[model samples]
Structures are given as C-alpha cells and as structure tokens.
Target: MRDYVDQLKEKRICSECVGEPYLQDQIEESGQEAECDYCNQTGRTFTIEDMASLVEVAFQQHYERTETQPDGFEYAMQREGIREWEREGEETIDVIGEAAQIDVQPATDVQEILADRYAERDPGAPREVEYEFEREARYTPKKHDDAEWHTKWRQFEHVLKTQTRFFSQEAADTLKEIFGSLDGLKTQAGRSVIIEVGPGTEFTAFYRARTFESDDTLQEALEAPERKLGPAPSSLSKDGRMNARGISVFYGSSDPIVALAEVRPPVGSKVLVGRFDVTRSLRLLDLSALQEVEAHGSLFDPAYVTQIKRAKFLDRLSRRITIPVMPNDEPFEYLATQAIADYLATEASPTLDGILFPSVQAGRGQSNVVLFYKAARVQAQDLPEGSRITASVASQWDDGLEPHYWVSEEVPETPKAKKADQYAHFFGWDEHNPVTQDNRDPSLKLDVQSLVVHHIAAVEFRTTPYSVDRSRIAMLTDEENRTGDVPDF
Candidate 1:
C-alpha cells in the first residue's frame, strides 16, 4: 500500500465530500464505491493516496516556494525594520482547499499527506513553509533571444543612413526575410495584408491636395490640374516619408480633410483638393491591419511562448513604420520606410502596386495611401482633335455674405473625324503598340466634379503645456567670507 494510504487508512474522499465542481465530477466519474471518511456517508470514494496525487499535480503546476530573505540589518532597514517575517504566501491547508475548492477537513488531510511526502525526500527540510500561486511568474514567459532579428533592422537602417544608400547586402537580406515573414502573416480575422482595391471596392477613391501662395500659380494649376496635382516628375521629385529623392510616388488620403492637413498650407494660402478614382484593380499592402496579427495558443505549449514574443515585436514594428516623423528628421528617419516601400513595389511576390497606412496627421478614422511610380500614372481626359480648352475661376460675394468660388471650363469648336473613319481606326488598330506619349500605364482617373478649394484663414494647434521652475545657487570663496579668518591667506 502507498504511504498516504497507510497513514490515512481510515480516510476516504467521495465526490460529495469535495466542494469544487470539477474535482467533484472527476471523483464521481472515476472513484470506487466506499464510505467517505469526512462525511461518514457511503458513496463513490478515492483513496487518500489517489487524492494526494491530484493535490501534488495542482501544486506543481500552480504553486512556487517563496524565496528566503537575507539576515542583515541593511535588508531589514530597507524593509522598514520589520525583521520578523513570514513567507509571502497563503497557509498550506487553505491553499490546497481554495485551489481545489475542497472542504476544510479533506484539504487538511491532503496537506498532511503532502507534508509526509516532502519529509521523505528531505528529512531536515521545514514542513511549514508557505507556498504562493505562480500567477505572475507563469504569465511572464521566459525571454526568447530575438536580439539577432531585431539587430538586423537596426543594422539595415544604419547602413542606409551612413554607409551605403544604393547597394547593401545586409539591407537586402534583412528586408527579404522581413517581407517573406510578413507575407505569410494574416489578421486575426484571417485577412491577408495584401488587399485588392479599385472600382466597386471599399477603397474606391483617393484625394490629393496642393497649396498655392499666389493667383498665378493657382491659375497655372487649374489649366492642367490633373497633371499638376499628380505625382511630380523625377526632375522635380523630392524626398518624402516613403519615397527617396528622385523617386516619385503618389501620396493621397482616403479622407479629403486628411489630404488637406498633409500639405500643411500656410494660414494665408489657398488649397485645392481633388478626388481621383481608382481606375482598375490593384494590390496594396495595408500596414494598419498588421496590428491585429494574432499570437494565441495554449499556455502549456512551449512554442507558443516564443510566438507571443514575436507578436509583440511585430506590433511595435508596425507602429514604427507608420509613426509620424518631424520635417527636420525626415532626411534620415525616412530611410527605413523608404527602403521598405521600394522593396515591396519592385521585388515582393505577387507584385504589390502600393501601400496603405494610417494617417499620422489626421489620427484615427483616416488613412493615407502611397502608389509606387508604376501605379501612380494618372489618365488624361480624352478630347476632340485640335480642340482648344480654357479654364476660368469666378468668385462673387453679396453684401454681408461669404464669397463663393467656382471654376468653369470652355471648349472651342474643332475639326472632327468622320464616324466611319473613327470606327475603322478603332477596329483595325493593333492592341499592342510600342508608340505612346507616356510610357507608363494609367491607374487613376480624376473626378472633376469632386474638386474643391479651401481658403486658409487660420491654423489651429493642439499642445500640452508644462510650467517652468527656477532655482538659484551661490558660490563663495574663503577670501570673500574672511571677516574673522584673514590669517588663513
């Protein structure tokens, strides 16, 4: 017979004798017919040895021994001179009863059984030491060494900013691994980051804004506003959050207000905003959706601990990619994101055309988009051959009323091709032609009716203020304070 059974030969626990519903059910289903010692009633019962095994398993999984404190005055002083201390844990019997939700008598009996077992292993060890539930420690998984992967990103950024901007093997390898891993990640809702967007989709249109300081510039833009407001040509292209110098990419927003805010127009300047329709289907990586990437599994699984750490790192990385960068820091701070954008556009599998990210200027409920050079081409309006077009803006105001501004387009009559000739040319022309005015394919069409002009009268700022505190200090030499001590010279 087991030692516990020999020690408690007269004690047997039944399902009805235990308070925990799960433990009660477990005993009732697997226990044998015997009289319960505690209740003094005949029913299904488990031997004391069997009950001790269950208690031991629970202790191993949920309890940890408290550490012993040092015997020193300094340590005691730090603890506020409280020298006499008990272990920071619950009573052994109370812990066992509460953990299994068993009645006091049965819990005490189980505690005695465990105490005897502990004594058998180490005869000189104390049997009264308290035990704490490993709640905090269990939740804090062992740290996985992710420093190598994290250092890769920092190294890549450093190389691009200081050493090599054009070609760096370290940057390329790091980006390849990152993109490869991200490509397989999915949102908690099981949606891929690469989403299809265009006509008849949730993201059907994008808005771009431009600011003008003078009437001449505004008028010049109105003449061919589609071309003027579109992505700038390589010669005029400047560095941006996701595009380096000489690299042109379309930067727009889902919300017109966000688009206007992004340009940061001066208080006295005029801003023109236009909506552009997504002409066809395109693939874009949505960075905001990365926040929902899930890392969930049973706590018992060792592999899940590493996954949780990686998921946390990914959450931080997603924030870093989209966080706003100040204007002065853009030159260096944008290198990492710019490199990511370039790689996704040219080298990523399935060929992404653009990226969608949260708008830092407008905060939540707004999103910003960037279409790479290949997908930034805007379609020009089709007009009759030799047709002359002119644009005019009119602003009128009545007394005590706000001024209203509007634009009008005028077209002059021109020669037209015959219907038969037009049809013949359209039908006979080859689908593939090398000759073209613009080498790139069009991906966006301007929605002329959605144009609006905003006159900036004031700028608003949101700020947090801190009060300044001041203190004064004075220094004196022995000579300056020698009223009674001149002998010291």
Candidate 2:
C-alpha cells in the first residue's frame, strides 16, 4: 500500500495486513467480523500469530548479518515501526500509512536497537506487546543463504555504480564495516551496502577473468607498476598480494542503467596457515633479508609490497641476455660467460624479458642464468659452484669481467603484505645471519638488498633441494637437467 511495488519482483505476497495498530475491533453490539482500513488497502489480513512470526524473523535476520540490510526487509515484522519490541514483553502498535514511508535512522549498536521507544505520538499510538513468536522453520531464525548472497551482491552493486575504478578487498571490508555501524550508509532508496567475501581459491574468485572495455585512461592505469600483474601467479603462499579490480559493464538493449558491480576477489588463504609470522615484517629488505620478504601474519604488509614493486620495475626495464645450453661434462660457469657474450651480440627480444636456461651442470643438478656476452658460446668447466643463478645487466651494470656483468644468486622477488599495510619482525630460528647478530632484535632487523652468486660444491646434489632462505626453497633433480625454467614447463 505504501507503493513499494518498484522494490518488489512479484506482487503476490504472504504475511498479515500492511500496517500495525489498525486491527479488527470487536463490535460490542453486533459481535461481527470487522476489517481495519489499512488491512483493506493491503488486500490481506493477518492474525496475531502472523504478526509475531514476522517480527521474530526480521530481528533474527538482522542479527546474523555481517553486511547491512534494507529497512523494507522488516515491513510486516515491525509493529508501529518497532514501537513494540521488548525482550519477553508485550505491546500494541498503530500503523500510519504515510508515516511508514518516512526515513528512520538505524540504531547505532545492539544496545540502541534494543532500547525502549517511548515517544508520545497520537493517543492511540502503537505500544510494545509481548508475543512468543515461535520460529516456523526448523532452524531458529537462521539466515537464508540465497538472501545473504543477494545482500552482498547488492552492496557490491552500489559501490560499482558509485565509483568507476578498481577496488580492493580491504576497501570492500571497510565499506561493510561502515554499513554495519553507520546510519548514513543508507541510500535514498532505503538500502545499504555490505560486502561479504569468501576464501578465494578458484579462478572465479577473481573478477578480472571477465573482459573490460578499451578506455584510454583505464589502459594507462592498467599499464602502471601497481596495475601490471607480474610474471608470477603472485605466490601468495604468503600474502603481500597486489592486483587490480574493476567493474563489469553489461549493456542491455532496453534501459542502459542497470545493476552495478565492483569486481573483487574473495579473501585468500591466511599466512598463519602457512606458518607465516607477522613479527618478521618489521625489518628492512637487503640481500640478507630479501628472501624473508614474505610477510608472516594475516595483516596487510606495506614493506613487502615495496619490494614487489621494485622487482616488477626491474623485471620490466630488465634486458634478457640468453646463455647457451652447456653439455653435462662442461663447467657451467664458463658456459654462463659464453651465453653472456651471445647475449650482447643479439638485439633484445621484445617478449623475452630475461633469458632463462636449463644448463647441464657437472653434478646431478641444473640451474638457470641471464648472460650478457658478445659471441661468447662454449661449455663450462670447473665453475666454483657446480651451478649458480647469476644475472648481468649489459651496459648498465658492470661488475664481473670485461663486458661488465654480475653473476649473483637468483633469489625470488620478495612477496609483500596483502595490501601493503605494515612492517613486521622475524621470529624464526636462532640469530644466524650477520645482519641480526643481536638476539635482542625485536623484529626481523636484517634484510637482503641484492642476491649474490656463490659456487656450490657438487656434494650438495642428490635429488635434494635446499632453501637458501625462507622465501626461496630450491632443489636439483635429474629431470631438471632435461627440461628447464618454469616448473611445469
């Protein structure tokens, strides 16, 4: 009767008459059935049981929610617009048609929501009544799964329509928190936004799987350092995760403006599950602590994020210098130098950001490197380390020999906190590295700046892999000598 038809999908509704207070008054003289004016308008009538059931349902629904719901959700449930809600109490209510449409401020907290409503309105105004509204369903006022899903989707839609840009899970979570607490979150239509995210594991969890438009601004933003998804799958095995999220535009033939959506990934696995410690995040990153780049806790780590950005920049501007495949008997160090020469001879490959190799080591293991040599092609012999991961930035970086190349250990780019939020201190093992000689270092004080390449003795090989640091664990295998580079590849 209040003309909420626009919000409804189907008109055939259940429950009692529209408003409260206007009930069938007993005719003392005739003792005949009478209908209230409000009931007549709704085209339906409700009994006391119906009213009780509705209120019970509404309160229960509003309780289990992590997101905000709409005022309309409690139409039949609220008596005199919540003038009659008292735990284990009784009261009656009046239903004013126009008054129902007026906007009401949502209660700030549970205490406020359960407080007494004693405003003196009309003499026959609604009053709180005690009614043991028995739960109809087997579950006592349990939230409907479909309804919960719809509520979250509605919140997502609201955000998408309001802002046209990428969104983060933290932003989504923050919005949900606000909706749950702030009354200003309610929109003109009487609905509120609330985000609910599940643990993301499958590809569907990521919204970018769907295609977007070719907007110039978007393209430029997407190309930015933060926008570009790096060469890796983002090994969130520890967090420090970074990715871009955008809204999906669905254009229909009829009305263009429709439901909105802010694409966001569900929450990922927690770092604690992976034995990660947040305390270690307090340290700065250097060669000694680079591999410890993986943040330890569930919190978003900002420092880990810095290293990720730096690595991406280096990888982007990095030039790939291909090293040749050395035979088994050859020393890999010399061949690594040869590949460096060949790397200098050829023009840089557009797609090849860096040269990765599966060099045949004298030992049972194999390794990879990026060389910058000019027509240098030969086998390796008596390389100090049986196999090593070394990198050389031709022309720009001059460290090793004549052409100037640096052969250092190939450490993984440090992973960061989920959304670049905090600093952590490490709390693993005894004080081992020189950077953290003092056991009193509260957080992980040592850090790793650049990786160093050191020769390995052949004895360390036996289908065995070792972790140079926590972030990078490596193993040498016979099959590694067969294929190379990417694990699956």
Candidate 3:
C-alpha cells in the first residue's frame, strides 16, 4: 500500500503541501513503513487523520485555481490514497490487478466529510474568490442566425448582380412571388396604352425616373401622412415637384455612350447627354432616342474615333473638361476667373491649355458666345484719382437704408390691376419692385480687377455648343483663329 503523501503526488497536486504541518509530523514520528514488495517500493503508512488532512489540503488548492470544489471528489480520493476494504466473499486480487481496477464508488464519502472541514476554516482566507472571468465569444459559426434585413439585401443583390430589367419575365415572376398582388400585371406586358388627343398628340418626352443623390427623399415622400393610393389624375398637377414616383439611375459618368452601355438595352432606350456641375450633378434631358447611326471609320485612319480609347498614341489622354458658369454676378465671376488664372500659373497649366472654344454665355437667355479673354490685374494704386470703376469709392446701395414700399405710380384701374398683388404673391415675387440693391453685403464688391494669364499652350478642338440653337457640333482649331469651323463629316 502506498502512503497518502506519495499517492497524492501521482495525482495533479504534485507539490509537497499536504494538510496541517502537525499531521505530517505525526505520520513521520509513527515510523511504520508502507511497502509493496511486488512493485519493490517503500513508503510511509498514513493514519486515518493523515488521509483526512490530505483531502482537506487538496480541496483548498483546487479551489484556489478554479474557485469551486473538484467536480468528482470521490474519484480523486480513490486515485490518490484511499482504498476500498475487501468484502467477505471477495478473493484477494494481485497488486497489478488491484491497480488496474477502478472501483466506481469512492473509498470514502468525501463530500460529506469535506463539508464540515471547509466550514471550520476562516471565511476571509486567500483562496476565496476568482477575479478572472472568461470573456464571451464573438463569432461562432454554429451560433449564426440570418436576420430579416439580410434576406432583403440578398434579394436586392441578386437582381443587381444578374442585371435584371424591370420589364423582364424574371423580374415580374420574382416580384409576383414576393408581393402576390403583382401577378395581374403579367398580362399587361409592362406597357401602357395611350389615347391620342389629335393627329400628333402623344408622349413627346420619355417619362423615366429622375435620379437623386440619395434614397431618403423617396422614403420621406412615401411616409407622408396625406398620401393615398390610386388618386385621380386631376388631383395631381402635371408639373408638380412632389416626386410621387421614385426613379433613380446609378452611374457616375455623364457621357451618353457610357450611360447607354450601363443600361444594356435592346437598342431603343432614350438617353440623356449633359455634364454634371455644382448646381446640377446631372443636367440631362431624354431628348434623343437611340438609333442605328452609321459610323464611318477605317481602323487605320488617324482621325478615326479620336475619343480616348479609340486613338492609338494618345490612348486615354483624350478628355472633356467641364467648367460651370458662376451666377450672373460680375464680382463672383471675376473671383472664379482668378482661381482659374492661379491654376494656369502652376506647372499643371499644360492640362487646361488644351481647352478649345471656351466661351461665356448667359445662364438663362439665348445669347451669342462672348470672347472669354485672359484679364489683367489692376491694383487700386494703378488707377486714376476719381474713376467710377475705381476701388476707392463704395456703391450707392451700401447706405444701410431700409427698403421703402409703396403703391405703383399707376394703380390698377380694372380687374387685372385689382388682382396684381395676388398674382405677384402667387409667383413668389415682390410686386412693388422686383429688383433690390443690397451691395453693402461684402459678397457684391469686386475685390480684384483682373486675373492674369501666364502662358499659351496647344489645345485640340472637339465640339462647340452653338449659341443659336444650343446644339453641340464638332470643330477644329488652327493658327488664324483658335476656335475653327465645324468639319464636314
């Protein structure tokens, strides 16, 4: 039989600390040798007190690490020191046979015994509480569950990924399966029949959805409290800006060719062609319908398809530059020109030097293209003593006088005159005087006289938007005049 101290070492508690120091001393003083001749080993024989003390010490050490008692105390004790006494009918097994067999039952009822011993110990001992806690796991594949939004996003992605047209059979079937009410639309073939008013009365314009910067506008409109389903046409004005129908196109390119390629249609879609600027990110109109316009070109010709990728040497260097016209104010326009002038003064002037037929036009009127000249800077010190356009004097409108209102010199003598004020209010304009001068505000003053142009550079002319009809046509540049006449194709 192995002693309590030696047997405990074979278990996880390999340290020499075993119960009270006095109990260990008592076992050492007994001088009885515990030996197993078959295994050729000798060890001290432990008394009943020694065995109980060993269990108490082992329990506390285990609690220090885990903050709980050992899960199976009985099995632990049996493996360490305690042995079961043989019954009357049972024959003595060999040493190896006894070591091999594990009695399922514990040698002693350790739980009942340890309950009393642990209770006797001081409450505020070192091995009392566990400070470290196991953190909750983040992503466990087995714990994953799909959410409602996930399913919705997946359906949306499927449509976009497959490039499904709204009128396509697949799109119709999918929407019908999801909504149930759309099944009736299948017989309509996604087209509407229009009754003509006269000989030529028809939808002269293609009514496609206007693209917005974000979808929040549509959300707000749909959730409005007064909106109803399927109202009469008379209830809504023809030019209403309510945006009752939500339509959006997702393309960053302003080129008509690129927009057509993005839609991937069967060749008859209406296309919008216009540049995106600050006031309008997309100022396009669906005036032109797609048609089989003949392309005349030989792959070997140098002038053939000068648009970037089609060219051999220049390759991707071809570009269309868009400069937005400032509001019809002389001061602000001067400032904008200065910005462009300062840009040309830098090394990057070569890029913008290539702009051809850069002309100025009225924002809201059909006017002839004015020659946009590179202006010179004039300081206040360089002007004469008392010039009207000089910087020394301020404008007459800056006197800080409040605007005076009164009836016109000629009042309305008839029904139309009586409704003049109401008509003015309806049109959101002041009837007394439509124009007001408030130049005291610093924004109106001309801070600088001019912007200097640094150097001249080579520019390739492509097209010009004619001031007469507002139609863009192809042109070239030469020595006589920088902007040349349109080439005959």
The digit string of per-residue lDDT tens for model 1 on 1-489 reads: 366436684578888877666567767888899888888899988876687777666565435555555456647765895555544656677777776667877777776666666655665655454333222111111344446557777888889989998777788877876676556667798888778889888999999999999867777677667767878866677999889888878999998999999999999998989999999998998888766776654332335445655566666677899887888999999999999999988889878999999988888878999999889988876655544445555554555444444455544475566232222222222224444224677999988778888899998877789999998755456775775443332
Q: Return the number of clashes found in candidate 2.
A: 55
Candidate 2 lDDT over 294-408, as tens digits, reads 2121111223233333333222212111222234523322322222222222322211111222222321122122211111111112123223343342344356333233335
Off by over 4 Å in 3: 1-143, 148-256, 263-272, 279-489
Those runs of model 2 whose alpha carbons end farther than 4 Å from true positions after fitting are 1-143, 146-163, 166-446, 449-489
Output the better candidate (2/3) by TM-score: 2
RMSD after CA superposition, every candidate: 9.8, 28.3, 34.2
Error of 2 at 244 (Å): 5.9
Question: How much does candidate 3 score in TM-score?
Answer: 0.14
* Candidate with the greatest lDDT versus the true structure: 1
Ranked by TM-score from best down, the candidates are: 1, 2, 3
Best by TM-score: 1
**Would you list the C-alpha lDDT of every candidate in the order shown?**
0.74, 0.24, 0.25
Superior by lDDT: candidate 2 or candidate 3: 3
Tell me how candidate 3 scores on lDDT.
0.25
